[model samples]
Target: MDQAREDWSPHSAHWGAFSARWNGATLDIRPYEEDPAPSSILQNFTTAMRHKARILRPMVRKAWLDRSARSERTFDQKFVACPWDEVLDLLANELSRIRTEYGAAAVYGGSYGWSSAGRFHHAQSQVHRFLNMAFGGYVRSVNSYSAGASAVILPHVLGGYEDVSRRNVTWDQVAEHTDTVLAFGGMALKNSDVASGGISRHIERDAMQKAARRGAVFYGIAPLRDDLPEEAGARWLPIRVGTDVALMLALAHTLLVENLWDSAFVARYCTGFDIFERYLLGRDDNTPKDAAWAAGITGIPAATIVDLARRLPRGRTLITVSHSLQRAQYGEQPVWMGAVLAAMLGQIGLPGGGYNYALGALGHTGRRFNAVPIPTLSQGKNGTSEFIPVARVADMLLNPGESFEYNGRSMRYPDIKLVYWAGGNPFHHHQDINRLRRAFNVPQTIVVHESAWTPMAKFADIVLPATMTLERDDIGAAGTDPRLIAMRRAMDPVGEARDDFDIFAALSRRLGVEQAFTEGRDTRQWLAHLYEPTRKALAEAGCDAPDFEEFWERGELALPSAPDDGGFLRAFRNDPLNNKLPTPSGKIEIYSKAIAGFGYDDCPPHPAWLPSTEPPDARRPLMLIANQPATRLHSQLDFGAYSQSKKIAGREPVRLNPVDAARRGIADGDIVRLFNDRGACLAAAAITDDVMPGVVQLSTGAWYDPEPGAAEHPLCVHGNPNVLTRDIGTSRIAQGCCGQVTVVECEKYTGALPAIHAFDPPEQD
Candidate 1:
């Protein structure tokens, strides 16, 4: 039997597919991956065991007794573990049935987070590849919240695949070279990926202390703390979130009005200058409203706004955190406006003068790998469009939508009877958590593929076990490093578990398309097929990494990176027009001709603000947002002890301003219910001045903790923040997710609410 499918002996999470639910059925199990001629088996054993111990370490000191209070997937919970064969058969049958009734379009593919860092065994990569090979394919949406804004708006702004390109200058240029920085969101080196890992505020304080000793001046404009070093002596011009464009436009108008504009640089490079000046800068009778008008919207004093704009230094200037623009009703405007502000100074396209997404640029400095393209294979007639871009789930699921075109087919998701989820955990990433749980309940079925159980998997009809990165053979680039580390199966399965690749490959075979995938080949043989292109590339590069097998056994192979250049400043300058940007016009599209072609008038040609979904309502006065945790990435493997150990004690805390909390009669450490029209989160309040007033922020990625009797375990009921976030505003600029806006009202946390268990098979119910 193929190694990929041979692991499905008997007892496995896959059994849920067979009987609608696992009902205590059992079967034969085997050592999924047996290593022969074990070289350094002990070395590998210790490494793997250490990680395994680390993952389970929390369990030793774990207070499962109380974790049980919020726990959805407890051993004591009445569950019926069943056989893998039955589960696989049922899933195959149901999938086939769904396809027959609704077509391939009836299926939805959902993914979140990199399940494992391993290259080959990544749940997302395999899932996408398999989905394409199975059903024609589903609409796909990918990215994290921290960078989603960049991924979405940059292409529209830069007029290309925004991920390409490198900075012509470095951070040193921003520090030593630039004069005035129109800091957008004010997130500095610490919160950003620029520091490699995030920098600590204490470390940031030291950098600021050093820069301040030199007597530098910084005018910080952000809704939150300006990440400027204190030693540089910073002035905070705290602006309202999402009102950045208005302030920027006002500043641009001021610059143009005072005749302070850079005429020379404007003449050197930049097209459409006249139109921008006329419409945005406001000349003649249109005498644009000055900084005061912007101040009203942004909450910065008009005089202060003007003074800061005028005070900018003469040399290269930078605009950081342009993502603030996306926080409002009209999100793109601020980003575009920031660029317009740079253009007004004739500073853009100059060294350290413009804006770049924090790590937005992907510079492949080396010669492009010249590997031949893999033959385009059909995703065997699997199933159809029951799949919407999971980012659009709030749009497709919550609100009934008029049929929309997807994957060349027009469809709606109302008929979606079963949802097969793998790879991503929408619970952690989506906005408006409380609302998502309800919307999720509306679906007839929800199944998840997981190694360590998560909220999504708990609510699933079938919880398929998966292999961890350390326990599976996978391949991937080191990204920064030159070596390719082959992930070897280190530890044995905890119980009834199989690698995701094995689970899906077998499921695909049972669905009648096995030949297209494995063709009955073993896992190693199939891996060789996948690695062929990589092998060729390594050979071409004269890599001295051992033969693929030896490399696999030893587990590391370094690859070369291309050279570096001042990619930031001189990108596409040679042929801006023909520079192959993904837009209709390849150059930096100050005007998005492609979006205009798509007929999304709201998006328009320029980056403009559209009202966010969370328009202020009388019922809910506070705006809500979700932020990421430092320890975890989105919602992968939360069961590990290291992560759970990091959880805030007492209750999940919602960090809000003390002023706002005081007004609402809430206090520090006080249990609060963060309620919106969509749903409510129960957490203690951390009323600190660190957060700006009027906005409530939660570190999402908490394991869903269901109300005491929630029909679905709230733990199982991972809140889809998307419920509070609307999807219809922005066009499909790139992927489906849009910037989020939500309203919040705080109330004292009233202990466990209710438990909601999902439906069992109709027979069991």
Candidate 2:
């Protein structure tokens, strides 16, 4: 018989349609007709589906099973295969013991973002639901790695997180009305390609193309040229690292001095501007934030800075700030200052105007779609509410009783005995891998549900093999996206792997809460249950939607597009009093009194120029930027052929300026060692002027592979940038990660290179 072809969508933000050709036992995937140009993310679907690193069965760490032979070699340890019943029983017993002894607060649910895009199989929601139902509850986390700073600070400044995600002006509006788009940190095209929960239409690239065609002049204010799209005709301004806030302040100051400040707008819809103006001038501080001062700090010419500031008010403008700016020291400033600058331009609610925290950072930004909230597995109210900032996993593990300030509240870290992780990988997201590894050893028991033998899985006490999205039936709909795609099971589960729902259901049965967990429904029944609401929503919107059975058979449903509203902030701008923001002032808080009440010295009331905490030692003058990878989604398919093809000499590629390369006697393709006070990593040098001098670009998400016990500088064989990144928080107020605050010295490696073992499985005794 001919192979059965089934339509399905993978778990990504740039949701491309695909046809899975199933030949009895195996599956072959190809892009559907709708996906005009399949990206590298689409090409690697098969490789991710059939990688060698996939975990086949339940694995128990030998050291944990045999108490007598405990070794410190966590990464090098062997795993012994165990049956599903035994593993489930062991997990249930341990969880019960922990609850009985240490209480439910001792169990930490360590699931981050980057799981299956399917609404049904969302790993974080599923795990939380299971824990909430079976056990009392688990300590959870807030915010995400992408925009942790904005998640906390934006609420004080612009009312809520929606100002960044839902309220930002659409690209279509920009193309139609805006004349200039100044992208600070630039439009990260690669980062925007993939999103969580699956993308129905990958129109970000096309959106940029349209905007460019409509005569919107794009200017990239970043250290690298490749940060912006080549097709957008972006004029690059190689700004110095960690100096964006200084540049923004100078622009604001210039606007004030040149009589270009929107006094009427500020007087009507802003607060604490007088105090900010004093600081911008030389009244509060001895030094003025003038064009000259900004030029010295940002490396951009004074003329350029003044010209840009003046030009912004002449036409419809949008200041696009990437999330990376806030992943550094004083991370909140850039986000805050970007808004202040936009407010000063008096175009906060105008079409193609205002500040965008993440314009093209993800797939769903600024898309005109219906506001239907996708239903997720209900995580019942927790008996105990103990949580930490998302990026502080290592801190929580290491410091049990330590108190830290977060969003104007003092939060104490709970002593966690059991860590139940599913879906997300903390090893990839958390900084300072070596420190995190040490912290990982503190938990009494660590359980992980993973498809592949990632670093997180290898370190777990019990590793439960979970099926990938391809091997499961699911429904995918991104936030506010009109299209709903069916994720049909392409093939049977690999080996003894199971879906998260099945695994959690079986565990719930052992825990005596099986009915509560499953709600008297199997996988198929649950999928149909979830689809009913969506069908109802489509019908209400006057769009034809098939029944559950018909929808399952058809495989995809595209809802009619919603009418394009002017700008996301149009309602608020039209009537400030009636459609008031949820903030205390009911207007834009340029200087947040709420934040000031927190008394955080690092993060002040207003955006201020604070030098980064990099060592001033001349030997380590270069600033290392650990950016997002272009090949794969945060260590997801690093072993795939598409991702592997980007590897230079079996190591991550590090981009360096020609001047820096010449100064260090390093050439393109040369094996280089990047070192600082924290740790060392290896990478193949790519000599180019794409990066500014005294700066280097090493994309993060490389699987961390450290040499066993070389104390002085344990070699990171796989070029993971986390080896050198700081694990400190952005500020005492926000308490987000300062992952980008890294300074390192790079030189050509002249020693024998260590074999890359991060991709390979551990040896079995």
Candidate 3:
């Protein structure tokens, strides 16, 4: 056994808190001692920081440098190394020109954060603040690609996302009180391995294990069997893909017909129940959403649906819907129906007996909030109101001035000429990589701040090298996480990379707004300033508020956590009249009239099961589940050793049922081609029964390695499911991304294999 190194420097990642030290040759990463089920994602940090994929210096696209037309912009263009000062000057001039000629609305400030756990160095905040202060604001994006559908639908039904998921029904409550957990989209532990802010402990497995030991039962209702943790001793109900709404409706209908639904609670605390009931009982449609009906659609036995419905009301039940459910066509239905089913059971406000959205989707959720304030970097308000949904970036870029409906509002996409992105990668998040590639060529200038030569950087006209988390100091804290980790500098900046703050501040100086952007503070000063709010709150609460210097030496601090009191939902359940929800009706909207007014045929007023748009065709019979990767966080460090270790033949692995694999003559370890109308990708086949027949599980976040000179739906050498995914929105109302599920077929690849060059740097001039 190795001795506990004394020189380990503490740091934080979205996965968990850890300490690292260079053991002469390689980095030694250790999880926080308190974490019971530490994540293997921390191993990625050991090799990713100084990987060859790291962007060494500022670069400009050769075509852009040669003054080629915007259509010539592409990922294959050579990147010419440019000095930071010269590139910054060029970017500053471009910003001024774009603002003067096309106005600030034409300059889209694109960033999705997730770059660092440190609040001050957060890419989204840094980019938005820089644009707001230095560039006089830019067109922004609303909602996230991950939870776009739920973020919009939750407010109209129950309340805000934070009110329902973050502050209500914590893991502690689930462990102690929950008897039955009906996970519509099974709470996969891999999905919960990360949190938006840093997470101190990985508690989901421990909590589920505790619940299972106490006679609690969990049912994983998804196409994949392992969505639930093994410790939960969960029963798997392999429902058909994209039919969660139908199953939920059947459960509700059983409750109604059997007289098990709490009519008194529904009448008192909920609105629009009668309207929804008519549809459920088939009063208007003459088709009752019964168990038999759902059995046909969901591929689950009718008896199982009735049994589950009966058992739900027998004990304290927690109905959970994962974020994956809402990343499909008409994605809003499953989310709305999950809340309605919980409402029917009338267990919504009880401890561990309510509706939790995306409960195990992230680490910070299903946990109590912090009792004190945490460090926050203020992103100044946008000067312009023109914006689009996060998933609609491709649409906005390609269809400028095209009107679209979102949440009952009609808005047009702004004509973006200059795109300034920092921190996050749009190429990894957006669906239909081929369509996104075309959209990327629309903008006159695309600038990015990146730490690696990711596909997004390759597609950009200007690439500014940025520092990785290990290279800089930051304060790591999440609202629900108790630990405040001092993310100390583990090493100097790799290559000529600069901190996002430094890069933005330098640009601000070039743009003559340095004072406003930096607030006359350096990185250390900003950290101290950001820490003051939390420290002052701690002092006022009579808690230990260590000075910045003392805190830095201590490495981490444990903050107080709020008791699980069920948040706003509990308050509303206790007193509906006084403590009401933020909805227009001020109660649970079982069938929202506001949504009905929108008149979207796809998304009706009630939670109706609309047939999926991406139906299985003869050519593409198998359904592809483009879900989150278990190895990495959305392609952030795909070149790292841990991620590389999981790759099959240097390409991402795709799991298929033995039945499907045999039909295609695709045996285990066989390199297969998965294709659809949109595009194609090669993946190594992993034959397993975990995935149901007619369904293949291919995780997203393989660096999109398209074959050279194959434009317009080119084949990706690396397994990137987004290449075959649809680019359409969920529906007219929410306009969320429908990237989760797509139809595709696979066959053994008989052609010569293309070398995997996704991790390699682009051609340099």
Candidate 4:
């Protein structure tokens, strides 16, 4: 399949590359033949383009249309359809008024860049560029909800986030030389189903199978049995939730007591090991972090811990940490301590042996880097500097002007009057859905560009219908993927829906900055401009560099990949002084002095075990694991056939251990209600021993459908785990999201079931 058929057009998605064709009745999708493992998420494309939930035209809330006051905002309001010209005029006027009355800082340009795989029509770049170049600067956000803790802490401890995680070790190296893989948080394949940009092929499953066939042992240190794929045949440890640091500390203590640690490597390649040694030996805490001490906390036997520690061969072990570990309270410690353990083993730079943060977390990781550059749309320079951590959206809206700390800087939340969001749904990603709903009610003007009737679109004062990926033509490229695809348009735009770029271009014209925003280029011309850099780089690298037209005709171009050897870490290990790390000490910091100067009690100078704030309460005994969903990407196209097929009784499934289910008299397919202090949600019970006792696994990404009521804590009928998750930060320093683990209690539902309207369109006036 060198080239797609005449009727089919090539395209790419976050999941993988595919060819699609419209036959007047159905849209046919064919996965790329090169992809060894295609994601079932591709099933979302069959009925998604013309789903009933698609937003047909520009809509304005009736209450906001009557009066643009915050008091007029409510979830029960009706939407009034208006012409594109009228809605654009209203949008331009509101933006101008907000900028003149308050400042450009009062406008928050929000986008998460997941709307499309096409670089030219990327919603984030379009919105940010329009705001920055046309409307002056706007307030922005920093960091993501997934790797917030590690993204802040890694630069201080080792290196940049990508350097340590994506570019450090290769899966090919693991298949060749690794002996033991200690997965702190089990590397589930579901987490690797989709990458941020587009991925041509998924290799985690094949790589893990190869490594297992080479006689490498894998240890899954999580409560779920299926966290590690079936091909790996990993032994499950089933540790207690949020107690990973205790077990890691015990491993280090055992290495110290038995003299198995590499002393020379620690002294030369690492800093502050002696200071950390005192704490490991109980000189400062007098508790002696031994196997027995960790056994009580993690529920693993002391003998098992000791034997596992002894089995790890120095210079032959790879320590992999999943993103799940650093998405909880005191999340930074587990990531930091995993690096410390790898440093102790003296395997930071060896082939197939080292610390790979978030190795199996996404599809793009653990793969070789591209030899040539990829296409990227340049977002013009921002105008304002005021920003907050991405997970602090609720706090920023609720407490404007309140001071907060992040990394090392202290800043205040901006007094935002207008929120322009595109490409993302905060209702799905943000914690405590009820709190986020209140935050959405605070702003004077809320505008959004949506393709479907998500909760974000329903809450917006103005909703502009945006086009789906299949309705637009652009170029698709990813940083790690080797394929550069020409995303040809497969279908016409539905109703009055427009591309985000065209929508922003229209607004730019209304604001009298169309020249600067558009650069005299339409969507097709912009795609060519964005692809030029990649073409030049490929030509320079001696690869085939076809022009945009030729490449478009060919459908896809193959990019060369770099060697599978270790990257910068290899050079740093080869020459410590010349190729030093980006950290302050130029070496791995087991104990960071700069962090100690912050004087935060929650996050100490070094990685230490901190008791969770939400301890075991008799009222809420079960620990809820709010993880990512396997059916679809975060609440996108939840009405599709693939996502809908996984539902039981028209609701998301919640996995509970047979032990916990029996105690509560729950059975498979039984509707159950999960309640905590924050909120409650109803889910279908799936009783199985795959999950451990006293734990329940309910995935996120269910469309947020709350029962209409005046109750402060309304029950979500769609089983959205974020409704019950707390909206607190991991600590003051990082301010990362700690919504992964929470305490909750579940009971079989005997009351009448509430109808779910999450996928339905809102009422139109």
Please report the candidate that would top lDDT against the real structure.
Answer: 3
- Tens-digit lDDT track of model 1 for 280-303: 645644646478777767788888
Superposed Cα deviation of residue 662, candidate 1 (Å):
3.0
TM-score of the candidate numbered 2?
0.97
The per-candidate count of clashes, in order, stands at 67, 3, 0, 0
Q: Which stretches of candidate 3 lie over 4 Å from their true place?
A: 1-6, 68-71
For each of the candidates, the C-alpha root-mean-square deviation to the true structure, in angstroms, is 9.9, 2.1, 2.0, 2.2
lDDT of 2 by residue, 423-481 (tens): 87777788888898888989988999999888899899899999988778888777656
For residues 381-451, write the lDDT of model 4, one tens digit per residue: 98788889998989999999999888877889999899999999998899998899888888899999999
User: Which 10 residues in a row give candidate 4 its minimum summed lDDT?
Assistant: 1-10
Residue 438, model 2, lDDT: 84
Model 4 global lDDT (CA atoms, 0 to 1): 0.89
TM-score of each: 0.75, 0.97, 0.98, 0.98
